[model samples]
Target chain A: MSGVRLLVGTRKGAFVLTSDGKRQDWMVEGPLFGGWEVFHVKASPADPKRIFASLSKGWFGQVIQRSDDGGKNWEPIGNEFAYGAGPGNHLWYDGSERPFEFTRIWQFHPSREDPDVVLAGAEDAAIFRSEDGGRNWDELTSLRASTGSGWQPGAGGLCLHTILSNPADPAQLRIAISAAGVFGSEDSGKNWKPMNRGLSSEYIPDPDAEIGHCVHRIANHPERPEVLFMQKHWDVMRSDDGGANWREISGNLPSDFGFAIGVHAHEPETVYVVPITSDSEHFPPEGRLRVYRSRTGGNEWEPLTSGLPQENCYVNVLRGAMSLDDLDPCGVYFGTTAGQVYASADDGDSWTEIVRDLPAVLSVEVQTLS
Target chain B: MIRVRLPEQLRTLAGVGKEVGVEVAGEITLRGVIDAIEASYPMLRGTIRDPATGRRRPFIRFFVAEQDYSNLGPDDPLPTALSGGREVLMVVGAIAGG
Candidate 1:
């Protein structure tokens, strides 16, 4: 029987929700690492049974947990993450130079063909690759050689949050860092170059600089990897030639400052974004939680509000808090800062709460099993 | 044999009880007890202290009896009571909450 598993990473622990493709009834099992914070939990596409989770705490530093039999059991792997090229200096919030330090893993991207090969993005902004099933990791230091001195932290610290791997070209890769803009690697993460050409940020001294854009999220469909959608600090951007050039696509939406963005599996041009009120206030506009969809790839957008909260709701959707499954009709899932995980089994027309009262979800990932 | 008390989180990570017993060879010192603990539980190698600098983490503290041994050097000899296992060495997390 076909099934789906949703791995939820929260402020307190990790939860695993499973259902048989009907997407209605779900079995929730959770609080795995009881008191620790789970930043992300993701399954390997090549081997669905292999899963990786980024677990950490303010008192305990960081811990990486790996599950061989799906999410049934997990074993703690290596937790050591040291910057490769001796700690370099970057602009601090006060405009003073501060040395880069490794704090925690923010995101994990496993190789599509090899389960043992995975990539980890870390805070203080660096990338590490693990070839031996995450037992060890080596930093790809060459990426910093491109432009490391000028990178600064956004409000959330300098974190390498979003990593996108191309399905057609194995060597092509893209990663986004807050306050540093987007960077692309054509040689499988060995070398990188800033890809923030047409992006403009008013907060920085230079509005159209090469870097420092503070991109919250970036997503692209596997079928058409060249086209990308992004939720920037204040603008919804769309790139045509894979980040070489970007243009604003925040048309008709109530607000453009959001953190989560995703593309539909069946329809590549169909995209989704939750419009937060503004940069200072992270809640929805007018206390109404809505998911705006665009069918024309960029400009024209429509609010999908059949089953969403219409009034007296103020919740924030984080960057890694939303995901989509590749099943027929395509299920859309998102968790909120207010501890609610909602799902729309039929594209974004309506929704149902999968499970509530989870500790402030940090990330939600979906695995579609055939 | 020396008795050591770990913080709640470290105890949970190491899968131990209220306290653990360790065999310390040579003079009893802050460094000796930690080496023995890491040798016994490999998973706790980098939790209490950093492996790169060989220094205690800013948030982790070591206490012997009622006095704080956190500021003492790693090689400094600890209280003699610890040598006979009469007193317990406590590994504590600083009073910092998230």
Candidate 2:
């Protein structure tokens, strides 16, 4: 089971990567479920053969697709969920009418303890839980209640974009929303509390604000169950007390307003993030793409730009598009909004474009299969 | 007739500075407008619709007024309001996720 499997969620479709343990030759499987935008994709840790994908259908609705035999066959699970009611009665529970309203499942996480328990973070800043492997789902009230009164939508709205569960402790979970900041549940999402004390939001002038901060990605340390890393709108933060409190670890990074974060599968301190322009035009700063690596737990940062394009580059990497493999040396992969995929075998020291001219990739995952 | 507003990217790809206009006789369908647009600008032949299945590409979407045209038949007749120029057809590229 040394071979590495890659699952790519793209704007147009989804792709699977299979490698020959050596990491030299790779097999790419599909543009599966074409004509649908795949926002997030995950391979079940309990059953590597099973894969799940969250897809967006323009204005129709959002759906989840599952693959039991790798990427060979796909099935839509449950009914497609729409964001709002008809037209006028479109106010969410917190009395916010959705502008540019569209139903999209932004993040998906399979329960660390229960294989059937899948958590979904969707548009309108809502969280849904499935107990029967996504065959059915129920909206969790705890998350809906967290949106306080008079909640105004942010740039992406109060979007529930990231959901993370501790591998060592199933009872603990954390979810990051775009404008609502981060919330954690020590009782497996049954109850949640705000965890945005140390996080900073440039959108909000007040540095002491507790909620309404935008978070791009949240990743848990593979070994340390209590340690977690977050790439936020204005800063990168790390929490040692299971998200109870956070501290800024982005001491020497170029900028903090970019998406995408990855933690080493075996090393608790190693992580990666790609930094880009935050406002105005969100392209690579001055049209240059750079992936920053922090090996000393965000204490120090180094730029990894060996094999990436140097000239006329303006691609932006999304949040869930970057990931790491569990292989011995650990392989890193990320996709760009410019429709290209890059891979680095030697940590973040260098890179290579594995696939190009595909649809804009939204998310990427690596599953190991024998 | 279905008046579709081309998104910025599609407008760039089609080499048109502004919206491209096309006409359909009986029914307004993605296939119909796509054919009309490709006929007007052949360079956009395989850009929006897949050459194999003639289905709209993943990033592109069709909207009638404010409603999404997801499950509607491509050849479904344009509503009276849309046909009478009371509404505008939209071919939009949606931005989602992070």
Candidate 3:
């Protein structure tokens, strides 16, 4: 049966949930890398059978696993992420500078055209690409060494957590690094330029600096990649000019502090964000779990809380936890830190808890199978 | 043939038995056994040791007949029993992570 596959990464391992078009009943299959931390698991849009996963353990390091037949079996591929040493320094907590070091892979984006081509966004803010599937990797060194020297780590390590590929222009890509703002490359990651103009961060000494803005997450509808929306550490922003400039759009909703922001599948103007109380308070506003939708792109908003918890709920949705499936009515899915997966089949009108217990959900991606 | 035992996780990942044997023709040492194991099962590379530096991962220890050879040099001679194929060399994953 043609269905949807939710590739879920968790603090412990990876899980694959399958459901038919109805989106009601789901068959769960996994804890694949059993006790390891599966950072991210995603299927390539070009070929749904090709799935890539990043699994890491602080003691055992990291491993990149690829599955040729969906999630049935996996093989460990290249996890050797070597960094090039150069004259670059990052801002320490005390405002001092430190040399850059390679950490873990935060996001793995496979090519939309070729299944063998993939991109790995790493901690310490760098990009690596593999042309022959995941067998070999070479550092896309220009992204960091050139314009990202002054990058600083947000509470999490300074990591390239988001990679957005423009659907209109195949050669263009945009990556978001914590505390470093946004950067884009026109020629397929050979070179990169800061695309963080008009964005401001109050935490940094210079609110108007070119870099050091803590961008939590950025989202865009596949139909129109130019109209982008971002959830920064302090403000919700929108960019109409392919990210060249951004303006605050944290209009009438509740708190602007959030991590996950996503656009609807069909409606380019509609977006969804779950507002947390603040950085220190990571829970939802008034302990009420609500997903605020901006149908006009930004400024005006309405909370979708019919099937969500209205009281005594204190789960924080992460940056990579929310995703939208391109179905007829559009299925929106989000996982919580408290080990719950919620699915809304009716375009944010209501939701249902799909799964009750699992490890804390880390990242979620949907593959609409034909 | 030098008999080597992998940890539970590594065993499942490498699709091997609890203990697998690798052919080492010359004087057997930690380095020789590791090279033979990685050559035999290429997927096991970079898991127990760093692919670049070849240093044993801090959490993985080596022992043969109750002797911990983890601190010894890579090319250090294997224990008499281990080299003679009488005792199995065990790759241990430390009891870390709560």
Candidate 4:
């Protein structure tokens, strides 16, 4: 295994953190994309040298970029995968009817089975697939016109933030939306079905209803593709049979409403989530910052507050801020709204503030580069 | 009339450190307020809106009370309740990925 590198994307720019295994020394290089909002960052699982980023320019539009040499160079793949309205098509923005511009690419994943296949979940609930290592793309029909008008943009652009591909079966994929619950695709995104069995959504008329809930992040164990975990807007859930069915796993967590979820690379039953105030308030619960760890398949959770701020911690971590490394001893890290990055070398047992006084962090990823 | 609250970065460009008050009468649109604000602060002309189309830039987001105003036209009249006293039109810099 090579040294683990952490990539931190923020409101202003992006930071690359290279650690020496020992937590004391770190090399940080960044401010990439120059203030563009980077929603997601990931290194190719098949080739760590390849990197991808999803950037949103607020009112302008969203873009995807690729770097083959570990962030040494970059290229944009926006126009290649963009959905456009043809001559007779009426679904477009403005009078040009230029098919809705991708507002953001909230999640990026490369297929474990096919190194050339890339998956992206974007704002407006769109899922894209690229077969040539992100050089080209095609809109996946699983999230396309078949879902009907009910798939209209949610309050935040009907965003799809998380995409999980089964390590065992490349044909199976799962996606999470902010206000649209969860959907699973069995035929590589050609067709889709709802998988919100035990989820909850207060935004809908029925508070306990499973279908219309808000999902912030979704993660899966690399070894056990049948098990999936997610951090919902108001709850945490697990699906034992991939995403065919789900059960609430937030009984022991501090607050159900959280932004991100991280599953241990090799441990199928271990995962991590950061609890924050739900809809009414967006701060840390009771004015304290804590990361909860679940070892028993989310049946129970324990708060890991060691090396964290004890009081007056008002910063909120967004959905993409937290991430885990695949190193033997996984490195867990998260950035805060107040422009800070914290890292834990021993899973979620203890922590250290790696950097301070940067821009609000939007997402973080760990890449092992020799 | 509708009042617009400038973000910190735009405020600095407008030569003010804090919020700037702009009055939008008639059909209060995002474009109308932006044009008025730019006219008052010439240095901010191309910062908020594009020079040719006058479309809102990618970094700036408009909000009427707590609602997002990005999808609405600049000439669209805001709800009367949102235009009432002390109801501010906020221009915020949206935060993207981590």
Candidate 5:
């Protein structure tokens, strides 16, 4: 049977939601690791049964949980995330040098070919790869070596929040840090180069600096890995040349300052984003929740509000809270700060609240199973 | 055998009850008891203290016979009550969160 599994990471715990292709009914099993904050939960593409979750708390630090039999059972793996190559310094918010520290894993990117191989993007801005599943991790030090001192923390505390792997070529990768801009690697994360050529940020003194831009999120279709869509701190941007250059695409959004951007599973040019009011005001514009869709790539978007809230809805969609499933109609799902998981079975035409009041959702990911 | 107590969260993580008993091989010092606890339950390694710095986590406190030993050196000998198994070493998570 073809079904979909939604791995939702929440402020308190992680939930696994499953439903058949109809996407009408759901089975919610949840609160795994209750009282702990689950940053991200994702499954390996090669094996649907294999799943990984990033669990952390203020008192316990970080713990990586893995499940080989889907989400029914889990075991704690290595939580030791030490910075590689001396754990150097980066610019703090006040323009002072601060030593890089490993806080928690913000997101996990499992290998498309091997379930045992995975990559973790951690706070304090660094990337760690674990080849032996989640038991061991090694930081890809070259990422920090490429002008890390110039990097500074956004309001989100200098975290490497996104990791995008090229489906066409696994060796080619791209990662985005909160205030460090984007970087690309050709030789499998061993070396990296800043890919923020055309990005301009008014917040910085130099509008077009090489390595400082608060990029909220980045998305791309698997077939079209060279083209990228980004939701920046204040603008919606697009790149057509593997992130070598980018241009503003915030054509007609009510507000271009928001998080959570995703691409359609089948349509290479179709994209989705939830625009909040602004960076300071993290809520839907005008108290109406809408997922903006762009059918012709960028610069043109339409609000999808069939089954969404239209009045007094003040929830914020985080950067990692949106995902897409590879079904025929292309299922789009997203979580919000108000603890709601909304799913659109037929692209972004209509939506449904699968579950609500499950703590503040940090991340939402879906796996299309056969 | 030395009895040790962990916080509710650590006890849940270690899959144990309120108190756990472990046989310390060497001198029943604070460090040896912690080492024995970690050896018996590998999942609780980095929770109570940092692995790199070997210092107690800011929110984690250590007590024996109702005396704060968090500031004591790791190698310092705990109270004789712990060595005789009369008092369990209490590992507490400070009351900080609202």
Candidate 6:
């Protein structure tokens, strides 16, 4: 049976929207974690029925949930995230040092080969890996130790929000920390290096420095990991040589400041970005919800906004809120801060609102099953 | 047997009633009781105190016979009423939501 499951993480809980290959009708099944903040939810590539979720409560702290039979039932695994004894500090917004504490698990990357292996990108800028399913987690000390004293927190706090592992070579992994920029590990998270060779950010003190570029999100065609697209704090950039270098691709977009960036499943060169007016005003440009698609990878773009709102659509989309499905027409899905999940089944040509009301969406993920 | 009362949310998570009795061996201190409770209800391991720190979570507290056990050392012996099943030692969320 061919089906699609949209794993959505929201401010209040997690949701699972399932549908057959048609991509028209959906059965929404959640607020699964109920009153907890589901930061990220993902199913392993090796086993679609195995799902992992990062949940947090204000008083109870982080809880890792796992499901064996899809998202139907879940059990708490572990929530103990310790950052070693010293508990180093990162640069604060006020240019002072503050003790680094685990705040949130911004992202999760499950191993392609092992359902038990899971990697979590956490706040205070570090990586934690769980080898025994989601039962326990230990920090990859080298990844955190490699980060020099120059690392600082962005407006969203020091968070390693993006974790991408090379499909062909599992040893090659890349992680992007807010304000701290991108880092790559070639030895299976044992050793890492700063991969911001040509990235430049004027937001920090050192504009042309190696690190401290507020990388909002990074996208690529899973088949071609060498070509990477990034939505930076104020620019849309692309790298052809595996992030060895980057050039501005913010071509004809209305605004370059946005969070979400995604690539079409079938088209390697095709990319999508929903631009906001500015960093402070995190809404669709001019109150119109428009999604810009760059067919040539960069330097050229076309607007896709037939079924989207063109008036009074002031919703903000987070970096991890947009994703793509491997349907024939290539479904594009994203959720907004206003609690709406919209899906475009015709490759961004038209759109449909899957769900209009839920908690404020924090993250969106899709797993294609056969 | 020690009667332990968990918060409403935790009660739901643990799938338990308002009161659950736990059996502890040897001297029934706060640490020993919590160890027994977590051993019985594995899901509540880190809900009260951090697993890494062995210290109480910031917004969680404990109360026994109306006496504050919030700051009591983990190794300290709790009031006999709490350990003897006469009164319930409550694990509560210190902050009010509404």
Which number leads on DockQ? 5
- Candidate lDDT values, in order: 0.89, 0.74, 0.87, 0.74, 0.91, 0.87
Where is model 1 more than 4 Å wrong at Cα? none
Q: Mind giving the per-residue lDDT tens digits that candidate 1 earns over A20-43?
A: 888999989988888888989999
On lDDT, who's better, 4 or 5? 5
| Tens-digit lDDT track of model 3 for A230-319 | 999989999998899999999997999999999999999999999999999999999999999988999999999988999999998999
Q: DockQ numbers for every candidate?
A: 0.50, 0.04, 0.54, 0.10, 0.69, 0.65
Q: Compared with the true structure, what per-residue lDDT tens digits does model 6 show for residues A79-186?
A: 778886333767787888787777778899999999999999998788989999978888887876776466888788788999998899988888898888888888
RMSD (Cα, Å) of model 4:
10.6
| Off by more than 4 A, model 5 | none
Interface RMSD, model 2, angstroms: 11.1
Colliding pairs, model 6: none
Instruction: Provide i-RMS per model in Å.
Output: 1.6, 11.1, 1.5, 8.4, 1.0, 1.3
DockQ of prediction 1: 0.50
Candidate 3 stretches greater than 4 Å from native: A85-99
> In model 2, which regions exceed 4 Å deviation?
A80-102, A148-150, B1-98
lDDT of 5 by residue, A18-131 (tens): 999988899999889898899999999988899999988888788888999998888889888888894389998788899998789999999999999999999989999999
- Worst 10 contiguous positions by lDDT, candidate 5 chain A: A79-88
Q: Tell me how far the alpha carbon of residue A152 in candidate 4 is from the true structure, in angstroms, after superposition.
A: 5.1
lDDT per residue for candidate 6 within B19-98, as digits (tens), equals 89999877767788889889998888877777767878888888988888889888888887765688889888987568
Q: How many clashes in candidate 4?
A: 11
TM-score of every prediction relative to native = 0.97, 0.75, 0.94, 0.74, 0.98, 0.95
Q: Which residue segments of model 4 deviate by more than 4 Å?
A: A84-101, A113-115, A152-155, A206-210, B1-98
Clashing pairs in 2: B29-B74
Residue-level lDDT for A101 in candidate 6: 79
Best lDDT among the predictions, by candidate number: 5
